[model samples]
Target: MNWKNIEGLDGVESPGLLVDSDKIQQNIDRMIEIVGGAEHVDRLFPHVKTHKMPEVTRMQVDAGITKFKAATLSEAQMAAGAGASEVLIAHQLVGPKLDRLATLIEDFPNTKFAVLTDDPQAADAINEKCGDADSPLDVYIDIDCGMHRTGIPLGARSDALRAHIDSLSGLNFAGLHVYDGHLHDPDLQQRTDKVKEILGKVALHEKEHPSPRIIVGGSPTFGIWAAETSWHLSPGTTLLWDFGYGDAHPDLPMTIAAALISRVISKPGEGKICIDLGHKSIAAEMPLEKRFQFPDLPDAQPIGQSEEHLVLQTANAASLHVGDIVIAIPRHICPTVALHSHATVVSGGRVTGDRWQVTARDR
Candidate 1:
């Protein structure tokens, strides 16, 4: 009945992922609008980890977003293969990943690839592995503004690392990479202020030094970085608006573009109905209460979940017969998308008979 619905569900299978093709394009357009307009599309270096499909990456490329960011080599390969002009493997490449990176560069010569480095020794190691003078690897100084997952703090140590990277002959020192994904305060103003405070030092450096680029923030801080033209915006979750983000940032114009389709399989108990959706169907990292939501049936509560079955308790279960369709919106669409091999594409309120491959996942 809402944006997540498809006109026809007869051919659609249960416990499947569905994406609204039109809404995806709309979200891309809105992202462009949020950060100035069509002209500023170049500043948007979206992360393809959410919808990992090459079709989605190509859609962004078609919308004038050539530069991209990814958390894995496979995602970078997917983006480059899908026509990305430049892609950054936002995560550090270690061990065999370096050999894979070199091979990726050789395979996708058309698309320039960059990587994150927070340690000088690791930078030297990367230079030794994949960097070449003829086709040097682009290196960005990963700054741990807050998300201490992988980055150096912005200070003398980071500055020294930048200098060391610059001295390296085989690598092309890029700029600073700050992923404040930890900052997801629902209050827009608080989130804005927090990110600004973290980037304050980097902002000052940019004012003094001219050329080094700064890629900052993700979906939560999209608008915060959008207003500042200098910094590049890398948002992953915004691509396929999820129940988690949609509920958190209601003011944002992004609409729900993907939904989990499930069917009631059995009325096992008086107050419960079992569906096909299970731990394998959706992301299970979140708490049980926040795993997924039944939009049509808000009162539905997950009473049991296993590999291929999810039992829910709701007063409406009595009215729901076997094979009755139920639509679920995942709290975290990125991992949930990875759980599926392909997503059914929906358009014009119906199935488009198209399935986009989840090419960037499982590797």
Candidate 2:
């Protein structure tokens, strides 16, 4: 659909992703404020998987956020190229990916890059690749803080793995990376207590083999870790909040920085209006209500969604006409951002300059 008539969005079209640069800056500032002030800004190692755009990474770098956590090798490379002084590939890389990581280290000597490893085999692979290139890489021991996702259990076995990594030739044992993504209770105190309980294990592990550093927590428990402990924080979704986290943690001081701008395409039934937004436009990992929220039509309920259309049932359907734009905030901003190739930049209530490329979408 055409968006030329939409004020201030001269070259934009329907089914576009709009990102408010001001809101992003506000989110960054709020994170710094949450961690006390600019002095603690370096403690933030925000995960770049949420917003893969290099422009956003550069924004964080400009804000004095030096370290970043990336899920993919491409994302780590993107962060290093964006002038991020330090980047952590939070996921394990094996086979050729390990070689690529070594290449990245060789390519960007100025940027410090590291990867997570829970298995000794993966650590050996990393060590082999880095040794072949004659470039040493920093390594973080990924601890499974009750997540059971991908990390060594927190105990003697974990300490043994850390010892193994320390003995490796081309790898340096930098610190411990504990991600408490499962503790997403809406109550602030509950989240705080859960984080404390999980980190208590890390503290015990440190008693025998003290870690040089520790990076912990994700967006769900960022405020808890930021206030309760002095570990490096790795919150990703805080930069661009979604309905899931925002509704779960109302105490956080973040605004919705990204939105899906769709247009009404058809009037299918008496109370049904179909929009251009489909499963592809927004993230569908959560339930219907939690997947997205429509600010323009608060009472609108998603009745059905197909590849290219999202049918909604609402009493205000009659009020919305064809070609009318509707703004929606996704339940998960990370995958929602990956669906689009570019994001239209909006500032001061108007589209400003060109769109930002979603740089690291594939890998």
Candidate 3:
């Protein structure tokens, strides 16, 4: 049975998310194997923002992975509910989120919650919302590597800020969070070399001040981080990888475990076919043609898309007919998965009719 083939998929509704339960487990196992198996499971702080499913988080917990990283408070809450011992919200809190984090910490007393902060003001703000010193919120100093999207640079200022944050009664300075999602070279050694360069600075910083923990990299740079002894890994896409990461790093060894199923709604012309997949179904942040690639119709050209329809020109359109369910591998799966409320789960080569609720999708 093909990993991509879903038995009894004919009954599934059109334009729905499809996730392989078997493949999900395989990915989890592979992740543990890559990180040096069960003994080192403590180092695996996978991000739940990819699947956003409590079931997936629970599976990781069952596999002995207790730590999780989240992008949203809802995701953090879901992970906590799934029995995660530690949940780190990698994004900085602002406005009402600080209060919401307080609620999350309060609700899941057993789960140690942490937040990443690059700003001293934000750290001070988070400290104010942590309730009290007895339950101090764990705060990791987000260090800006080359990707300046977030985090403070590892410098004198960062050291001073860490000292300041440590002084706060309600905040525990966790460690460093260096997220370098911007680094993506198809070549593994090149990526590794770049990571080693970055680690030089991290080494210097750690030499200066130790004891706190550190988290590094998303799925793209996961392999590089895994080789290191000190850094804790928080790779999200390893669970349900998409074509974007799949194509770029074949060496990573993660399967494309998620997809979107759409129906061919119209045969617009001789070589043009329109599918029910639209920007609303699949992620449209990428270019029109790069959004999704048909596995069978690999040469299909995506010409246009709207909220409910996507027009594609393909020589294979002659073989396709109306009502035909088209399986698409999203170039960007994270946003595409978020578009659907739930996914039709495929287990052991058959559609289980069991749904995997994307529990923390938008939240």
Candidate 4:
């Protein structure tokens, strides 16, 4: 839980999040350049939900990032308190959290607040809340491009949503928010085409409602979106690259800056070595179940995971002793990051600092 000036503990701690500030900066710069700098795009709203460290967000803002995308209202508050002028609550602000959103808006009047809503009821709630606050809230209509998880259907309903925002007393109609979460295909052309189709639909609908501030793309599709024209990218994982998306996109400079560094806590069987971290440390939902690479045993399978141990079946488990530290590259970065409270940053194999107060530790 400690997160401050761990400038000399690299060769000491068993295992923890290790951030290469160099690679982190490289990733940010690459994203900025790819997006054609701050002047060209409306605003580069980098999502802080991935790393969740205020220091990392500060770094992005230092590099000319003004807008931020946060999944939860807590994340939005965290980012805004950290000096982010504008924040997009990318998730629905439902139920009784309207007051919290209002508090965030009232406290940080300088910070422009926006929320995405597919349901008109939720939109009505948001509109009512903003009206009570007597503040103009920016609202983006979530488009169901490919990811059917959340977003409204992309059609005349989009027009209806736009009209609803315009009718609201204190809401500004921002453009569209389309995230193609299903386009994680390894095939380059297939992924590109899927995104193209989604954005093409948005473009078609945009003819009727030319609001002009469309937010799209994630860490996986940032490059693909950049290759196209007139689209802004919201890359959260670019700050702390993971085993899942980073394996395919090597052009991204960030690496496994955060890791579950555990010891060989137990040796239960012949060819299986169990580490201290499991679903509790790094969430079990990985990109690929059988795809895990142990530096000690390159051919190891990160097969099954329990609450507190990772079962690694390998041919050379004898090489791993009971006290030796082992690093685990989590399959999915977001939830894996949520497991830890802070990261032990390293540079040139020396511990530089501890980024504490991991902001995105909860739902």
lDDT of 1 at 7: 74
Ten contiguous residues with the weakest lDDT in model 3: 1-10
Any idea what lDDT model 1 has? 0.89
**Against the hidden true structure, what lDDT does model 4 obtain?**
0.75
lDDT tens digits, residues 1-363, model 2? 122233566357768888888889999999999888998898899999999999999998999998999999889988999998999999988888877877788899889988888988888888887753355678898988888898978777777888888788788888889998888889988888898898787777778878888999999898888888888999999887877788889999898888888888999999989999988888888776677888767889989888889999999988889987777878889999999999998877778877899988878
For model 3, residues 50-115, the per-residue Cα lDDT tens digits are 889999999899999999999999999999999999999989889998888888887888999999
lDDT of each: 0.89, 0.86, 0.87, 0.75
Model 4 residue 232 CA deviation in Å: 2.0
TM-score of each: 0.97, 0.95, 0.97, 0.90
Better of 1 and 4 by TM-score: 1
Task: Give lDDT tens digits, candidate 1, residues 149-245.
Answer: 8898877888889889888889988888888979989998888889779867777876765446888889988987888555799988888989899
Off by over 4 Å in 2: 1-6, 132-135
Report each candidate's C-alpha RMSD, comma-separated, in the order given: 1.3, 2.5, 1.2, 3.5
How many backbone clashes does every candidate have?
Answer: 1, 0, 0, 0
